[model samples]
Target: MAISFYKYQGTGNDFVMVDNRKLAFPASDESFIKRLCDRRIGIGADGLILLQDHADYDFEMVYFNADGRLGSMCGNGARCTVRFARALGVIEDVACFLAADGEHQASVERDLIQLKMNEVKGVEQIGEDYFLNTGSPHYIRFVDDVENLDVYEEGRAIRYNDRFKAEGTNVNFVQRLSDSEVFVRTYERGVEDETLSCGTGVTAAALVAGMLGMQSPIKVKTLGGNLEVAFEQVDEGFKSIYLIGPAKQVFTGSVSL
Candidate 1:
């Protein structure tokens, strides 16, 4: 069988997207997904996204890590998936879809996607760092120099630490450029490496920065590009959180399976 796929990227977090409305692709094929995500052998992407029909939403977003594991809600993947849904005519300027985390809303203005993310109840301060879940579990640590830090080595150490040994957590190293701006780098668990950008990771970083007295409309600079995170502080925690960034389609092709 030949499956047609689209490539999409949001701040360099690329994904191989599939229009699975007909349920053509067998999502249970883990090995096949892993092989397809292999950089040298098949279509290289940080992850794979399947846009499927939903009962009460524009579509259902099914995401998988490069290692072929079902992953949590990916902020970047959700943004890219919205763009993919639009390209397929499943949606127009606005979208309401169900993701692994929960239901989400988004609006597209050209290449920029503003996705409503999950609300954060609270953040656990572990020593000098903070841990939280913004659609995905993340450990955020501030750094002095984000550009020169060894993200892979340091992130791997914390990711595999005994505290998060059972279910690993994505790690984010953040450096503040200003009161309202920051530079961030992430080591995603599923990809198991340092990626150019991570939506949820940066969102967590921005929210943490805000909790620490940073202003709203936090500007986050990732290796791939720039993203903006805005939120409203509520009595319990935070609400009306949005992750805004660019999601661009790279190409389209068919691969034999």
Candidate 2:
């Protein structure tokens, strides 16, 4: 069978998107999904996203890592899925969608998407580093020089450490550029490599920065491009958190399954 797919990218976090509202895709085939995301042999994406029908929301986002496993809530993938939903006329400017983490609200203007993440109640400080879940687990380490760090090696160490080796976690290295701006690079677990960008990781880093007395509406610079995270610090945690960035369609094609 020939399946039509769209390629989308937010920053440099790219995904292979399929409109699976009809449930035609074989989602249970992990090897096929892995092949689809293989850079050398397939569609070459950081992950794959399925847009399916949802009874209570605009749509349902089903995400899979490049390794073909069902992944946690992927922020950039969600943003790209929202853009795909808009392209399919499933939503207008505003949308509410169901993801792995639960319900989420977002708005899209042209290619820019502002996605509302889940409320975080706490941040765990592991030494000087921090750990948090912003729809996804992330380990945030404030560094001195982000541009020259060995993200793959250092992030792999923490991600595969004794405490986090089982389920795994995304690792982020952040360097504060100013009071409101920081540079970040991430090593995502599912992808098992240093990706150009990571939305959930960026959000986690921003919240940690806020806890360290930086500010809200933090500007983030990544290897792929730039993104912004805005939130309100509540008494218990953070609320009204928004991950703002641009998600654009790279191309569209049909491939045999």
Report the lDDT of model 1 for residue 88: 90
Give all candidates' CA lDDT scores: 0.95, 0.96
Tens-place lDDT per residue, model 2, 82-116, is 99999999999999999999999999977689999
Cα error, residue 197 of model 2, in Å, equals 0.4
Could you tell me the lDDT of residue 140 within candidate 1?
A: 97
Any residue pairs clashing in model 1, and if so which? Answer: none
Tens-digit lDDT string for candidate 1 (91-133) = 9999999999999999999879999998899899999999999
Q: Hey, what RMSD does candidate 2 come out at? A: 0.6
TM-score of each predicted structure versus truth: 0.99, 0.99
Q: Give candidates' CA RMSD values in order.
A: 0.6, 0.6
Instruction: Flag clash pairs in model 2.
Output: none
